[model samples]
Target chain A: MTTQPVTLRRRRLHEIVSPLTIPLVTLLLFVLILLLAPASLPKLVTGIILPGLTLAALYFLIAAGLSLIFGLMDVLNFAHGSLFMVGAYIAWSCNVGLDPLYPNHWPVTIANSNARFVIGLLVGTLLGAGLGAVVEVLLIRPLYKRPIYQVLLTLGLVFVFDALVRSVPAWGSDSKAPIKPSLLAGSLEILGRRFPTYSLFLIVLGLTLAVAVALLLRRSRIGMTIRAGVQDSTMVEALGINVRRVFTGVFALGAGLAALGGAAAASFIGVYPEMGLEYQLFAFIVVVIGGLGSYSGAAIGALLIGLARTFSDHLVLELGLPTAIASASTVLVMAVVLLLKPGGVFGAKE
Target chain B: MPINGRRTFQIAQSGIGYVPEHRAIFRDLTVLENLTLAERKRGDLRRSGDLIFGLFPRLHERLQQQGGTLSGGEQQMLAIARALVPDNRLLLIDEPSEGLAPVIIEQMMAAIQQLSAYTTVLLVEQNFRMASAISQRYYIVDDGRTVHTGAMAALRDNKPLVQTYLGAA
Candidate 1:
């Protein structure tokens, strides 16, 4: 009996790399790089940390929804990024159309931004949710027991959604023109540097959402069901809960969150046809690094990626690295992280 | 096709409750939320309350705990509690004794007996002794199909039936 406790302790220790190891190594590497290359250090830290955080925040918002869907229903939503792009387009259109209605709308009031943001968020979420439901009911539902088929079907959906988005006109000149809100157009001073206020807002909004989601999942009944469903969906279904309804709800929620991220990003960055693909890659990286199905892990992963990107960009520029090499810094960091911890920071070992 | 004046397609549409065989507690939700979500306002609140808490006192004690953190026995109790919230006349409990200690199994049997007082129970249990102790009628299922049905006591008294049908003597 005493040996049992000892064995359990040893197993627990062996199951994971002590949580302190990654942070310590990351910190040590960061310090050594700073000491060895002082001139390039500032550039790397600033460049990678700032924009990376911004981008990471955006990715977090998008991936959080994907995480929920994957965790709960075991569905891979390839069209997730497309839904986000659609949200951005919707926000742009709403801003262009609704701006004239408000007085002094040129400056973009909290009220005006609120109205447009809400409209974009709601419409995008609803559309994304509706599309998700349709995808599940039409495609994924039939292949419930077959995991491979579900993946393939969703992959096909990504192409279908891409084509649909491309069919629309590009932002300004044609029907497809990606619109930007007039309010989010200005920049604010950050550490004596002018930074886009909208981008900052986007980052804050992402963090707020991440916190809300964490609370919801931890506290709410629906959230509990979602957690339980992730572990064993069949058990939840047998509890007389409409497991089908829960699946639909989860899909819609994830899609809507992705759309919110898309809409927020669209206000700062103009909408383009391939915008979703670009975001999809970033979101996938964040989800993987943060640990799929762990919201807190996603947030932490986003922050780390953001900071790393900022630092890498600066370092590359200072070192006079080739433009292509400089651009690849984010990818390099992600690769290292993956090599170090395959399950990601928060994921359980398989 | 109609069933008892309703559509025959809705044959299984009567007041029904289901207990999933696997452990699927909404990992993110509290015990109370799990119970409340399944509850219907149309039913008698007093009766629902009495039926639910009466069977599982642990649920009442840990109403605020997240479903995922509960022990196996507690999760089972919560699962059963959630099912009873809807006030279903016919309750379906799947493998309640699975993975439970003997003491917990005894407590589980007591809860089932208490629930059977108000609602008709269709318990799907592999444990013959537990089923026979708690149920008046029994059905033996093999490969997703029902193979035998009879009085619980008859199945218990008959040595051949116990051994052949349930792998028990």
Candidate 2:
């Protein structure tokens, strides 16, 4: 009897300890280093933590939309990242070129940072939605039963869009300009450390949008259909819900959100051709880590990746590790997470 | 069988409740969301509310819970409830007692019987006893084609036919 209790206790301990070991050990190591070698630590955390968080938030924004589309439609939208890039360009052109083209009717405020931000967001969303709808009608609608064909077609679209964007340099002359709003131009002191106000704004915006998304998914009727459609789309169709429209709406919503993220990031990172690729890779990692079709998991995964990248940068510099080696820490961490939980942190196992 | 145009519209307008042979609950959505989405209402929340909760009381109780977390019986009930929600004039329910306990099957039957008061149901049941109990009319689908169509009473009374066709004593 005593032996059985001891064995049971050991089994329970193993269950608790095995899953938590890596995070706990990593946390302890970080804390110990902070306590003992505070001076050796790099300024990257202080300098880049906020920006890293902002980037992660941007990733979450884009991925949330993509995840929703994948969950509901079971289609991998390879053109999603391309759609995001297009949004940034649209915003840039709308604020700069379009204003000049239609000067008499154009609002003078389009030149300003705040107005450009609003215009960019609107234009990006609409353009993305329109593009998605058109693509669905032309390409995706026909390939509903053929998933492999859908993926290949979308992948082909990415290259086509990339070429189109590269050819359209004349659309926006001020592509290099970083349009930070005047309200968020200044720095603020936090714990005797100065932080950019724009970073703070980005963080606030990302979190606010995340919360709004959660509420919408839980409360709204359309949101309910989206949630259901993710599981069994055929049943939704059979119920006389006009599932084709739902698919179009979901695809558009996802593409729009990606565009919004791209537009927002363009204000900070500047409009560059490869900007979407950088975010796409990170967002894909976040989605994998969070689990497929789980909103809460995505949020948690984003925060985790954000903090990990920040901390890893600090650790590498502080430890005098090779810059390239240190830079690959995020990938290493993601690999480890996958090895530990194959289905991801919150994903359901088949 | 050639379905007439009028029958097609009737099936389309009055929702077709399809309880999948496999797990079809949206793995991401809550029980209430599944039920609500199944309704497919334009803007009438009251109609959806009355139909969904009225059919399955358990769904009302576990509205916030994820559909994936429910028991087999509850999932079955949720599937049925989802079909019945949208003021569906006709309901098509797949096997309802496939993996349910005796008590749960009884409860399921009661719910289906109650549903018959408001909606015309076309139940595809493997359980001959259960099918005979609830159906006013019966259609035996063999090899994806209808082989028998008659009143439930006629089918029940013909013991030899039941034995030969349904493998039921």
Candidate 3:
């Protein structure tokens, strides 16, 4: 990048352009929405923001994990989606298994539904993380240098996981809504707009997790070390760190975060065999747009995608355009971004 | 053969403070984060930071700068500082003078002497002037095996042998 002769003007322009791009694009979208439908803008925004935030938050879960693993380990784990699917399935099982205490298909009135929700998340996450560590140690670690071998092995696991889910009589390729705590089931009046309580909960959870992770990387000792390991693990090893152990721990953490997202999204997406690949693809898109190693970039990328999808769908419908076009809206947004900045919104060189 | 090859990596893991010929710096991390990584792996980071900064003050000034962006001398300083992180009984430095200016090399030699006062130094150096200036003893290797072992004084005395083996050090 530096080899190109840089005039002072270009450097100043770059300084101006770098920070303004994302915000300007975001504002342009809002302006377009306002111009297209001023009367329903408030209600439309409220409604759109719910699904938009939900989608963005869930995507962050998967994308963040993907970024961490890909950045640190240099291992392309094609089977990461399996971890997400396992999480949702575990949440479903936990819900059904606790039926005697809360009753199936009924919101709990006696025993706390919130407690049940926490239990489901905890169990699902634990199991998902365990599966991830086992997979990393056995299948993925050995194939780091051989991309072809990694793809073949992990691609095989992806099918194995999907088939395993299909084998379960209750799950069986079909989607089923996992239990939701009664507390999070309805809309809540916030400011002037009534917002879905679950969407708000997810937004809060997602923002908190993202901020917490960013803080950990910027502030914590272990986080600093892991970031360093991403660049030069040999330097870390020479410094007396057991880098193998750190990699395993991080791989498990990344998987655990994905599982948490799945468990949390179970009530939203429902547990199913194909659900992993769906979110996994969305995660890929988010990472590509956000820049692979950038956490904040991923968050912004997710929001852009979620909001774009919702707005594009609504706008297309209002204009009486083909609804089929709505499906490609997110991908279109990604393409546009790529066309402008080929390295992604935040990607550096590679 | 350079001990900087793969076999040296095995020796590198055994509590040795290995400053590789390539420096092995974490290019993406900031200077502060680079030192923090080393100290976090061993003992107290703040204590080590205070100690390392005393020797390589340039690192303290560029704490927020990325490792890749630093000058060659600064990167070398970071490498040596990282090695000093653990309670290392011996230091294994490979070509500290490589790619540095003469003034920077002199500064590095001074830092090496300071480090040696605290612990044993097993310096893998090619620069004979710097090596003879500080080394008490020397070993010359050919084809991955030791060919000569003697005092630095003896190596200096044997000019023709030194010239034949190391090309007029």
TM-score of each: 0.79, 0.84, 0.88
Chain A TM-score from candidate 2? 0.83
Residue A201 Cα positional deviation in candidate 2, in Å, after optimal superposition: 1.8
Candidate 1 residue runs with Cα over 4 Å from true position: A1-33, A36-48, A94-139, A143-146, A170-182, A219-221, A323-327, B1-13, B27-29, B40-51, B66-69, B140-148, B166-168
lDDT of 1 by residue, B1-169 (tens): 2346753213233566777786455544567766766655535334577767877777888887766678999999987877777657887788999999999999998998988888899988888778888899877878898898888888788888778877876
Encode model 3's per-residue lDDT on A79-181: one tens digit a residue: 7778988998888777766665634444532366666677888988899889989988988877866878978998899999999999977678778876787
In the range B1-169, model 3's lDDT, one tens digit per residue, is 1165533334555557778898978776778777767663445566566668888989889988877778999999999988877666788899999999999999999989887888889999889889889988899999999999989898998989889988976
**Which candidate ranks first by TM-score, i.e. highest?**
3
lDDT of 1 by residue, A171-250 (tens): 43233443444566677765556676667777788888887887777667677667666666655555545677888888
In the range A1-350, model 2's lDDT, one tens digit per residue, is 00000000112354455535445544564566455436322343445467667767888877777677667677778788888888887776665543544444244544455666677778887898789888888899889779999999988998888778878746432346766656677888765577888778778878988888777766787766666666566666666677778889878888888888777776777787766677777777777766665565567667667766766666666788878865676677678778777655555543
Q: How many residue pairs clash in each candidate?
A: 31, 1, 0
Better of 2 and 3 by lDDT: 3
**Model 2 chain A: which ten-residue window has the lowest total lDDT?**
A1-10
Fnat, model 1, is: 0.32
Pairwise TM-score winner, candidates 1 and 2: 2
Error of 3 at A310 (Å): 1.3
After TM-score superposition, the amount by which residue B53's alpha carbon in candidate 1 deviates from its true location, in angstroms, is 3.7
Fnat for the candidates in order: 0.32, 0.55, 0.49
Which one wins on DockQ? 3
Residue B37 displacement in candidate 1 (angstroms)? 4.1
